[model samples]
Every structure is written in structure tokens, then in C-alpha cells.
Target: MSNETTTADGGVRKKGKLGQRIAYACGNLGQAAFYNAMSTYFIVYVTGCLFSGVDKALAAKLIGVITSLVVIIRIAEIFIDPLLGNLIDNTNTKWGRFRPWQFFGGLISAVLLAVIFSGMFGLVNVNTTLFIVLFVITFVVLDVFYSLRDISYWGMIPALSSDSHERSTYTALGSFTGSIGYNGITVVVIPIVSYFTWTLTGAKGEGQAGWTSFGIIVGLLGILTAWTVAFGTKESTNALRAKAQKNGNPLEAFKALFQNDQLLWVALSYLLYAIANVATTGVLLFLFKFVLDNQAAYSMTGVIALVSGLIMAPLYPILNKRIPRRVLYIVGMTSMIVAYILLGLFSTNMTVVFIALVLFYIPGTLIQMTAILSLTDSIEYGQLKNGKRNEAVTLSVRPMLDKIGGALSNGITGFIAVAAGMTGNATAADMTPSNIHTFEICAFYVPLILIVLSLLVFMFKVKIDEKMHAKIVKELEAKLASGEIVDDEAQTAETVEAIDEEAKTLTE
Candidate 1:
């Protein structure tokens, strides 16, 4: 029997099963694991381990170069990501548009990640120039493929279900599993690296071989989970969806994105939130190792984040029912502000730090889930306003903003480590009071300021709430019934401009 059902507007939507939701959620697990390994730990490995055998001055210079490369490449990808999204939107294949990209992109990026983590097979010690060349090549390819997979993976959310509540459930489940995969890295990396180091080289400390092994293990896990997403999930198909799959000029899709005022506001707000949120991650290991001199306790933060996810992930849909997203966003941001204050005041106390993390994460998880829902909801908003549903293009904004934020974070992290003399072969004993102070300012205070900006933008600029979204959906259904909205590919420039003017006037 067909799982598809026709809506009042005569459009078809697929009803997903529990297993399909679980399978869709699994994609985030692999993606987050793969992403965190690169975003959170790759720099740490480069600064602390990859350059340990090189000359001090040369290593410092190399770190600077590598950091520059990372930031530049990620920034470059911001432009490329939208095109990739359009490509995905235009894709039609036997397997499906999203799944093929998810599978192949994930698989190839995983392999490249493993190879990159292997430090290009120790080429640096033998030939520095060759290592840099290969690093550039591999890293660029890895990032591109990773972006493709990320876009396709997230782009599936709206396609899974158009109902707001069901969409929230999927987003929350993905976030929950994704946090486990992302934060799980922090919890397991030290133990895994330590144990593997001992087993491989009979050493009790971190080594190249250990890091390489960790990469391979993560890669394999990524591949397996991505495969599950491809084989296990289903995409909703209808006349509209089928038409959307037809090839169109990416420029039209890109222009339509700017017409959606709500999407713009959400995108801007999420960009600030992402930068503020991710900027602090790279500094956590340094904080535990250099400031507190307790490397092991770093994992506790991850555990707290995971525990918070366990508690808050399921709570989102419940809380969302009773509270408006704007209110929830404000509450979460306010909690994070308090958490930062506590962290800053009690930097040296592990107990206080752990408490601060708990406070930070519970709300932090809520905020992330809300941001995702906001972004997802904006797709419908854009469709209503622009008369085109560029789901991949609209959703692509999230990851693009993430990469920009992550690049900035990497730059900040690398700069702090080098300036504080916390890089390669440095010990906690070697850190002066001034160095500790620098780390504190960059790690704690900077993100605090960014978080405030994010909250302000969200509170003031973003206006869509549950009530508004329901209204928009109802209007869209009417438009579909009246034949006012048609295939997005057939949307003409004059028609879109007319709708944009009407939308602008309505807002005013």
C-alpha cells in the first residue's frame, strides 16, 4: 500500500514511520562526529601534536600558515555551499536526490578525513613542502564533500514532514543524537588517544599513531551511519517535489533567498549564535590542560552536555507547546549569560566549572534546537513570500553560517594558543599568569559578548512564532488550492518581483 496521502490542497505528502525518523536522526550522529573531529579537535592536533617534532620557530610559523589556510578555505566554502545546495535541489537520480549525495559525500569525506588526520602519512618530517601541498589538496576536497553531505542531510528535514510539530520532533531527535556524536568525541578522545598511544608505541602519552587510529575509527563510524540514513529513510514525493527536482539556474534560487525577510533575520541571528557558541570549544582543552592542569576533567564538560541533551532534547517539543520560540530563545540566552558569568568568576574551580557547564548546556541545547526549528520554519516562510520553495538553498544558510563561525573560531583559537605559548610541547607549568589571563579573555569573555549580540538580534529582528507559522501554512494550502502557487522552476521574475513587493508592503 502507498504511504502517501493527499492534503486538502490536493498536494501529496508522505507519512514517515518511527523507524524512518530514527534513521533520519542517525545521519546527524555521523555528521556531528565527523564535523566535531575536524572543527573541535583538528586544530588541537595540529598545534599540540602534529608539529611537536619540528623546530619551535618553524612550527609556530607553520601553525600560523595552517590556521590561515583553514580560515580561508572555510570562508571560500561559504560561496560554494549555496551552489552545492542548488545542485542538490536540481538533482534527480534512481536512489533519490538527497540520499546519493549523503552516501557518497559522507563516504569520500570520511576517507579523506582519515588520511588528513594521518598527517598526510608523516610527510612533514620528510618533506615539509610536500606535506603542505597535500594538506591543502586533501583538506579542500574533504571540506567540499563534507559540505555536500551536510546540506543533503539537513535538507531532508522539511521533506520528511511539513507539519510543524512533527518537524520539531525530527529536529530535536537529530540534535539529540548529533550532540552525542559531537560531544561524545570530547568524552572519548582522550581515553582513546591514550590507550591507542600505549598500545601502538608503548607510550602513556598522545602520539601521531593514536590520533591516526582515532581518525580511522571516527571515519568508519561516519560511513556506517551515513549509509543508514541513505538506506533507512524515505523522501516525500509529489507533483511539487518532483517539479522542484528539475534543473534550474542557481542564480534564481540565490536571488529568491534574499526576498524572504524572515529567512534573512533568522540567518543573521543564527550566524551570531553559531560564532558565539563554537568560538569557545577549541579553548576548552587548553583551559583544562593549562589553566586547571586537569586534562581528564575536560571530558566531564562533554558528559554534562550529553546529559543535558538527554534531558532537553525530548523536552523541546513539550516546552515548545507551552512557550513561544522567541520566549524560549530569550530564556536560553539569558541562562547562557549567567552560566558564562559563573564560569568566568570561578575559572580555577572544577566543581564550579562543572556546575556552570550544566547550566550552560541545558539551555544551550534548547537554543540550538530552536535555531534549527527557526531555520526550518523559515523555509515555509520563504516559500509563501517568494512563491518558491528552495528548501536546500534556504537550509544551506545554517551550515554556511556555521563554517564561517567555525573558521573564525579556529583563527581565534590558533592565535590564542600561539600568543600564549600553549602550542607544541608546551606544558601547564610553563604558562605564566599573563598567559592564563589571555586564555580566559579569549575563551570566556569574547563568546559572552557575541552571545549577547545573538540574543539581541533574535529578540528584536525575528518575529515568526508558532501562531504565525500555522497561519502561513494555512495560507499556503489555500494558494495551492487556488493554483496561485505552481512549480518553483516556472516562477517568473515578474511574478516573484510582484510577490516580493506585496510581501514587503504587508510587513510594513
Candidate 2:
């Protein structure tokens, strides 16, 4: 069956085959698994296992350095991501622009990630300097390649379909699968690491060998999903895209990106939300291990997240039909605020904690879906205003902001772990009231403040809604049909065909 579908407005749109859509969604499965493993637990592995054998003072110093290094590298990536996005935007090949990057970049990064998780094969205990050097190099390279894969994977969404509802379906599916990948790791990591660590070394808790094995598994999953996207999905091409490619200019694209007011507003709001959300989630492991004194209970949080994903992901499209995205965004943020407050007041109560998790996650998923749709729509807003489409560049903002958030979260998590004496052989029994207070301030209060700010920014500044987007689409379609925004290359090809037909008529 053909992948194309007819829209209500009589436009030919590529909705993609169900199989293709599923394949595209699978890209996020591996991506989230790989990313969450690193973003959420890499620090845990480093502080708890990798440096466990070192002297306490020296290990503390090294952890500080590593945390700062992670923050610096991710902050530096802020500059690199846009350039990579521009590169993806300009890329063209027989296999299409985004897939090659998604496949190869995912493959290489997944391997490097396993290397990172390996703790340099126990080199930290043998030669700390060499381990540090190799860690930095491997980490930087892994992040770059992963960003390329992430940017390209998301960038392809706009190309798949122009219909807003269809775009929401694609976004929802990807987000849902991504949730499964991320939370799936959360659910299984403790048990998996514990079992493997025991099997490999007769260790009592998580160890280097176990972490390494888990990393390798996640990496392989990443590779498989990347390949699925590359081979199973398709990119839709058109005159506008062809025209945009011909005149692609990175510098101009950057300028155009900033000029799109709607994009900037949505990006800024989402950035705030991402930083707060990630920072909170990133510290959950530390919370469970130290505050609650039940690291195994951490997996239940993931179970809650999975349930939230199942409900929220499918509900987004349905809710969106009846509610404005702006309103949903408000509701989600408000629910998170309430959850944080609940956690802050009664964190030691496992039942309250679990209930807060449910409240926080269900709405959090809705907010994420809303933000993604807003960002996707802003691409069209930029195109309508600038007369060029830079899907990769625009969508790159999502991952870029995410990295920045992850960077800050890593830094925050590292600092809190150290300050609260939660690192290296420390148990919840070791934590004092003071340590728990510090954790609460960073994990709960700080994020609460940020989420509130994010809500305010979106409510006041972001103007694009369903009605506005539909109007923009109508105007763009009218302009395209009237040749008011014609593709010069496509026009030239048409002119050549006309001339050839005229010559044949004269000969006849």
C-alpha cells in the first residue's frame, strides 16, 4: 500500500505506513535507553563503583572533576549542536538525509557508550590518569555522535507528514516508546546490575562488570533500533524541501532560527521545563539509595512511569482535540508543582512518595507531548516567515536544551551526592537529617521553583495555538500554490520541460 494519504483540505500528505511509523518510533526506544542509562546512572556508576577502590579524599576530588567536566562538555555542545543540525539539514544521499546519520551515528555512539560504562576495564584502580584521559575522550566523542543521531531522528518527523494531527501521532508514538526505553532501564537496572555483579564477581551490590554488561546490552539495543529507523522508515520529499536544500546556508539558517519569535518562546519555555524536570529525575537514584534507604524501591518509580506513559501517550492526541495545548501545558505544570510539594512535606512515607510519582509523571508526559507539538509547529511558523525550512536546525533545539538540562542535572546530582555523603559505600543508614535536607532542597525545592517559572513563561509569552497554526498553514499553502514563494530550481526544470514540448510541437 502507498504511504501517502489525502488530508481533509485535499492536500497529498505522506502519513507513512504503520510499519514505517513503528520503525521510526523504535529509534527512540534505543535512544532513550542509551541516554537515560548515561544521564541518570553514569554518575552513580562513577561515584559508587568505578572509584570505589580509591582513597576517599582522592575519589571525592576525582568525582568533583568528572562532574564539572560533564557539565562543561555538555555546555560546549550547545554551540556544536546547531552546526550539526545545519549539517544534517544540508545532507543528501541515496538513502535520504536523516537516516544515514541516525544509523551510523547511533551505531558508533552506542559502542563508545559501552566503553564509557566499562570503567576503562578497571583502569581507574590501576592507572587513574590514563583512565581519566580515556574517559574524557570517549565521553566527548560519544556525546557528539549521539547528538547527531538524536537531531536527525527528530528532524525527520516534520518530513513524514505536514498534517498537525498526524505529526502529533508521530510525536506521541516516539515519546511513548522513548518513555518505555527510559523507564525500562530504570525498572531493570538495579536488578540486572545486582544479578550480573553477583554472577561475575560474587559482589554484594552493583559493580564494574555488571555495569559494563548492562551498557553493552543497551548499546546493542541502540544499534538495532538505529538500523530499524534507517531501513524501515522513509522520508518524504517535495519542491519546497528541494528548494530549501539548494539554497541552504548555515549562517542564514541560524539567523532565521532566532528571528522566529514563536520558536524562541517555545524553546525558552521548554528549556526551563526540561532543566527542572531532568534535574529532579536525575537525583531520584540518590534519593532512593540514601534518603529512603531502599534502592530496590527505585524500580517501582519506573513502573509508575511506564503506567503514566501508557495512559498519557495515547491520551495526548485525544485531549488535544478537546483542549488547547496551552491549557494542557498549564495543567501539567501545575500538577507537577503539587507533586513536588507533596514530596517535600512527606518524602519518607513510601506511599506518599509513590502517589506523588504518579501525579508528577502523568502530567509530565502530557507537558512533554505538548512541548514537542509546539516545537514541531514552530518549524512551520519559521518557514512561513523566513520562506525556508530548516527542520533539523529547529528541532535540534529540543535535544540541545535537553543536554543542557542533563548537564546541570549531572552537576547538581554530583554535588548533592558528595555534600550529603551519599557516594562510595555510603548507605541510607549513613545519611543524617542534614544530608536529607540538602537532598530535598536540591531535588525538590529547586525544581519546584523552575517549573513555576516555566509555566509562567509559556502562559504569557507563547502565542501559537491550534487556531493560529491552522491559519499559518492556510497562508503557506496559498503562497505555494500561487507561486508567490516558488522554488527557482523547480521552476527552471518546469521551464525546460515547456521548451522541449514546444520544440516537439514545431517539429510535428
Candidate 3:
């Protein structure tokens, strides 16, 4: 949705343009698809096969251990993702600072994914005293490349366009298209795994061999899909390009987060959302196996994705027009809360569970997209307040929170499973009523609780809205034009003005 306003000289305009909008959409689509793969597939693939090997319970433990290791590798990423982002923020190339990173980042990540998958298959001989070590090393390699690709990928958004609205629109586009890839990958994974495991086999069948092949295919697609954004999008800012020439301290770039309160809130809020999202994705296997009664033949989750995705765009416009973003976002998070609670409470009926999946998708997509748009807006507020533009640093928070939250969620889920007795019975063809309790919590309680908490951070803690951001933008533009420092007069005036406005209210 576009908001119209008159400038200081009374010229009417909307904040962002269409080109930047499209570019943001592509970048997000590419980025989202890449992220979706890790959440939906990686752990499930690992544990499902290992369960057939050694003791199923021990295999579950192994899956938890390895996936947790992958998650831990991601923590090291707190330093790495942003470091890549900072490098992109400070780099200057004829090709532009952000896109170059995207191109190489996507290509490199895809390559490493292949290695990760290849290693997964050959891991039988390797699954010994050195099992954990080899798996950790292999996954970490791909994880590092993912860090490079993800940080460089998202950092492009603020650098590409200065308009808050454009960032949202483009973010929506990226989200929409990327959902295609996201859902597509899951859909394909469902059939592909089923096919390889069921079809490609000797007396031993495919076993581990099948899953490994699946990883290879997933990795190749990730590489190509991510590269499309790097080459397809462009950056609009010139000031940032010039900023690269000064050779300022790299530490100062990340230091922007502590100094900018709006950005800090955005990052913190993102962290909360990331936990809910990762948990939601983490439970896909549970939903498919027990929630759907192990109808491994037909792909119910893939169907959920296709149906939910069809309505995401129109749903966004309807929610945005009727509810303030805050309320719309609340509706989205609350939907997840309700969906998960229901799943935990009474999901014995596959029919009802399937229906709830539909309900869950609309709000989940809405909340995810809205949170992303909010992050872009937060960056604009950061530039408005500080008068120093650092898109990469400012925008890095999304991916930063994503990996951090994901790591935390993985650690928690693994711990939860171990405590709840997921030893090997987690994937039993017939789950007992007691085990169903554990599955319910994983699917519903975890996601619903996290989302409700996220909404609390957003609704009660966040202060800025649209009006406040517009006013800040107007004042910052004027200051930029006149070289008037945002000193006592301007700072006090804006601070007070911020109180009277909307969108991004945390002027602190």
C-alpha cells in the first residue's frame, strides 16, 4: 500500500519507486528460498535415515547432536554474516557493492551444498568415532557459505533503495517469488525423497544413498536460485558508494546497531520472530508423520504450501488496508499461536490438522512479510535519526537474528526431544498416545508460545508507526540538503515530533 504526502515545498509524492520495489522482491525471494531449505529439510533428512541405522533412539540422538552442531556452527556466524555484510557495506566495485556479493555468495553456497549432500550419503563408513566430527565439518562448510550468501543477499535491500515503501513492496515481491522456490523445494523434496527411497535401491534399497542424492539436488538448486537475485538486482544509492572510498573502521559499521535504537528494536523483534519461525519449520516432520498419520504416500505439507501461497499477496493487501500494520502483524502471529495451540490440543483428526495448516499459512506469511517490511522501515528510521547511512549494517539484523534464533531453536528442540524421549520412536509407524503428546507440543505449543511472545515485543515494545517515519524522512532530507547538523535544535525538535507521529516510535 502507498501513502501520499506533500513535501516541505508542497510537492506531492510517494516515498519509493517501482524499480527498487521489484528488485527488493527478487532479492527477498532468492534469500527466502535459500533459508526455507535449511529449516524444512536438513534435520529431518538426517534423522529419518539414521533412525534405520544403529538404534532408532540412538539415531534420534545422533540427529539431534549433528543438527545441534550445525546450529552451533551458525552461532559462529554472528561474527561471520555481519562481517560479510560489513565488507559489502564498505566495498566499492564497478558492479556495485551489494550485487557482487550476492552473485558470488549464491554461487558459492550452491557449490558447498553439493558437498554437504555428497558427504551425507558416504557418511555410513564415516559414522563412527569420527561421525560427529566429519558431519560437523561438512555441514559447517555449507553453513559458512550460507552465511556469506545470506548476509550479502539481504544487506542489498537498504543499499538498493532508500524508500521505505519500496523496500516493503520489493520485500513482498521477494517473499512471494521466493515462496515459490520455498514451497517448490519442499514439494519437490517430498516426491524426490519418496521416489529415491522407494525406487532407487538394491536389496539394501536406497537407504542412506537416497537421502544423500536428495541433498545434492537441493544444493544445486539453492546455488542457481540464489545467483538469480545477485545478477538480477541493482542498488540505487550513491552516497554509500562514495562512503566506501574513505576507508573508515570496519568495527564502526557494526557499531551502528548499538547507536541506533530503532535498528536495535528491529533486530530484537526479528530475533523473537526467528524463534517462532524456526520452530514452525522444525516441526514439519512431526506434522507429516503423526499429525497426518504417516500417509507418506501423498504429500500433504506440499499441498498446504501451494494453497497457502496462492492467497498470501491478496491477503497482505486486505490486512494492510483494514488493520494497522501492528494489528495486522498481531493477527498473523496470533494465527500461528492459535494454529499451534490447536495442533497441540486436538490434532488427532488429520482432517482438522490439514484445515489448521491452511489457517496457519495465511497469518504466518502475513507476519513474516510484515516483519520484513518493518525491518526495512526500521533502517530508514535509523538513517533518519543518525544521518549516517549504512544499509548493510542496518539491514544485517534480519539475517543476524535469523541465524541466531535458528541456532537457539535448534538447540532447544534437540534438548526437548531428548528430554521428551524421542530416542527412536519419534518416527514409529504407529505412534502411541503418550508419544502423541510429545509430537503435539513440538508442533503447537512451541510455535504458538514463541509467536505470542514475538507479538508482545512488537505490539507493546515497538513504538514507531508510518507517520513518525515520514516526518523523520522529511526532516532528514532537508538536513541532508542544507548540511545542517542534527544538533540541539533539530534533535530536540525531531524527538518531540517523533512523539506526535507514527511508524517506528522508538526514538530512544
Candidate 4:
């Protein structure tokens, strides 16, 4: 028999196990790997591949166009993500709502990951117009499965735990595991395979053999990672809320989603952070090549340091106990400020740049993990305020921001890099060139400035902390149990905490 039942508020209520949460976080390794590889290295890979076989200027333009197209496709995903979320909400599988979506999304993502760099559609011989057409189609198709899976993956975060501390721990776990493994593999290890293939194929070209092989390897890994997550994830029945039988039209649902305020702020913060992140990640090639003067070490050196920041993520719950989420956001933004300033001012010595990268990413990484946890908190906030659990709707914010940020960043960054006059082989020795100079400025200066500004935005913000969250979750559970309007506001904060702590004891 079907297990889902409707709560008075029309939202699904369920709890997942600790083991499932751990599996879910591990499964997220693929997501992190794909994102890190694509955002940081994809443009560089394409540039190298094209330069080996084609003109340098033309190759730059080709990379720019392809990057811009990927961004465009990403922007389109804002619309697709919510639709995918609703479908998962409505779905019923013996395997559960989320796992099936995860399975299909993984399979599709793996196939396309390899296809994007397959050389099945040779780039060297294709005319500019033809190149644009084929590349756009392939990249857009890649985004489709990507957004679907992305929406489903993050949407499940809240399902893992209702307790504020547990949820923060889960988010931190995902961040920590993903940061170490993803960066380690993508940076330290990826080039080994790429370089090896380059030797084997005797494809003396820049990255034709390397990237094509790289894409295949990353894709196969993604498939395996995704499969593990799908098989292991336990989709507990939503002890509350009935599943929808009718399929949703994507546009109508977006209109409905647009009206959600908690969702709106989460979406906004995500969009801004994404813009900052994409620009930072996208500029690495230019920095190592032109600013650091080491083309070979460009990929790993500064980036590897960001892993230090991930270490701070698991400290979130403890910090949240002492500080509000908004304050934590400010802290993150402040750390970013110091990091960015160091890069902008003292990015000279290898040691200075390495320290700078560590400082910058640590706070940046905190904000990265915090944003989702805060948003998950808001999903509870959203439910209390709006009377609908619509967990998937709130989760859609990640993708919506992703698409907007990716599109704007990708397109704008491409054009910006070109206008700045950055070229393919821009080693530090090449820094005297004007575009390379602009590339350096945009890379360090822009992110630094944005960090200070982001801090300013949260100065007056109100956010729930550990105590406040306990009260909130307790009130929701009491109402769900009693089926009566207990003067929710009549209960003092102390009273609410007492009730919540009591209820949790019962649950345990």
C-alpha cells in the first residue's frame, strides 16, 4: 500500500536515516566533480585543443563562443529545474520519488559528458557557423539532464533531517567530502590521464586528445558515482501529503514559485554567489598562465588550497549554535574580503598566492555550505508562513540561480576575456599584453570587491539560529500532531523550546 498521507499544510513530512544521509553526501561527489571540472577547466581544455590544430585567435574565439553557449543553456535551466522538482514530488516508485530521477539523470549526464568532447563532430575542420550549431546543441542537451539531476539532488537535503544541527551537519558533510575528493581528482589527478592520452595518441595538439579523453573519464566516473547514490539513497515515505497524479506544466509552476519569498531570497543569494564563483573559477587559466607564469601548474596550485576552506564547513553547526545564519554569511563574506584583497594586492610570490587562495576559499566555502543550510531552514520557514511544504519548490532555487548565474557569467566572461585581450598561451611571461592585464584585474579584483559588497547586503538580515530553529520545528510538529490551532504565538520561546525538545525525545 502507498504510504504518503496529507498534512493539514499540504506539505510532505518525512525523516531519513543517518546512513542514507552519508550515502547521499558521497553520491554528491559526482556533482562536485562535474561542476569543478567544467567550470574551472572546460574553457582551458577547449582552448588548448583548438590551438593545437587551429589558429590561436580563432581558437580563443571558439572557446569563448562555446563557453557562452554553455552559460546560455544553463540560464534556460532555471525554467526546467522547478518542473523537474514538481515531477519528483508527484512521482511514486517502489524505489522512491528521488532515486529514479537520480538514476535517469545520471545515465543521461554520463552519456553526454563523453559526447561533448568525443571529436565525433570534429572541430578543426568545421566552419565557424557549423561549429556554433553543433556545440550549442550538445551543450544545451547536457544542461537538460544536469539541471534535472541537480534539482533532484539538492531537493533531497531537507529530507535527510528535520533537526537544524543534523541538517547543517549533512550539508557540511556534502561540502567536505566533495571539496576534498573533487578538487583532488580534478586538479592533481586529471592531467595525468589527459597527459597520458596526449602521449599515446601522439596528438601533439594542445588538448584534442587530452580533453576528449578527460571528458570520457569524467563521464564514466559520473555514471558510477550517480549509480551508487541512487541505489543507496533511502527515500522514506512522506508520512504527510498526498502525491500529485497530474503532470505539471513548467511555466505555470514557475509563476507559482515566483511568489515564494523565502525561495526568492535563497534564489537571489544563489544567483549572486554563482556569478562570483563562475568568474573566479573561469579566470584560473588566465591567472596561472599569465599572472603566475606557470602554464603547467596553472590548474592545481592555487585551487588546491581551496580545500582548506572546506574544512571549515563542518564547523557550521557549532558556529550556528553561537551565531545566526545571517551572521555566518557575514563571516563568510568577510573572509572573502581578506582573501580577495590579498590576491589583488600581494599575489606576487608563489607562497603569497597560495595563502591568499586558502584564505579566500575557506570563507567562500563556508558561505557555499551555509547558503543551502540557511535555505533548508527557510523551507521550514516557508512552510510555516505559506502552509505548504513544497520542499521541491524551495530546492528549485539552486538550479534557478545556477542557470541565471552560469548564463550571465559564461556569456559575459567569454566576451570580457576576449575584450580584455587574453589569449590561449598566456603565461606570466605574456602578462605585458593588454588583454592579459585585464584578465588579471578581472580575476582578482572583481571577486574581492564582490565579497565586501555581499557582506554589506547581510548586515541587517534576520536569520534563524539553533534555538530559533528548535522552536520553529517544534511548533510545526505540535500543530501536525494536535490538528488544532494552538496559539502558536502564545507560546513563549521558552515554552516552544520545551515542547520541541520534548517532542524530539519522543521521536528518538
What are the C-alpha RMSDs, in order, of all predicted structures?
A: 2.6, 7.8, 4.6, 6.2
Summarize candidate 2's per-residue lDDT along 162-193 as a digit string, tens digits.
77777888898898899899889989998889
lDDT of 1 by residue, 66-156 (tens): 9899999999989988898898888878887799988898899999999988889888778888898889889989998999999998899
Q: TM-scores of all models?
A: 0.94, 0.93, 0.84, 0.84
Q: Comparing candidate 2 with candidate 3, which one achieves the higher TM-score?
A: 2
Off by over 4 Å in 3: 1-30, 55-61, 127-131, 202-206, 238-248, 314-323, 412-430, 486-508
CA deviation > 4 Å runs, candidate 1 = 4-14, 238-243, 488-508
Worst 10 residues of 4 by lDDT: 238-247
Runs of candidate 2 with Cα error greater than 4 angstroms are 9-12, 486-508
Worst 10 residues of 3 by lDDT: 238-247
Worst 10 residues of 1 by lDDT: 238-247
- What does candidate 2 score in Cα RMSD to the true structure? 7.8
The superposed Cα distance between candidate 2 and the true structure at residue 258, in angstroms, equals 0.9
Query: Which is the leading candidate under lDDT?
Result: 2
The weakest ten consecutive residues by lDDT in model 2 span: 487-496
Candidate 3 lDDT over residue span 189-295, tens digit each: 66676667667664333255566667667666666656666666565543322332332356766665666766676567767777866776666656555545564
Model 1 pairs in collision: none
lDDT for model 3: 0.61
lDDT for model 4, on a 0 to 1 scale?
A: 0.63
2 versus 3: better lDDT goes to: 2
Candidate 4 global TM-score: 0.84
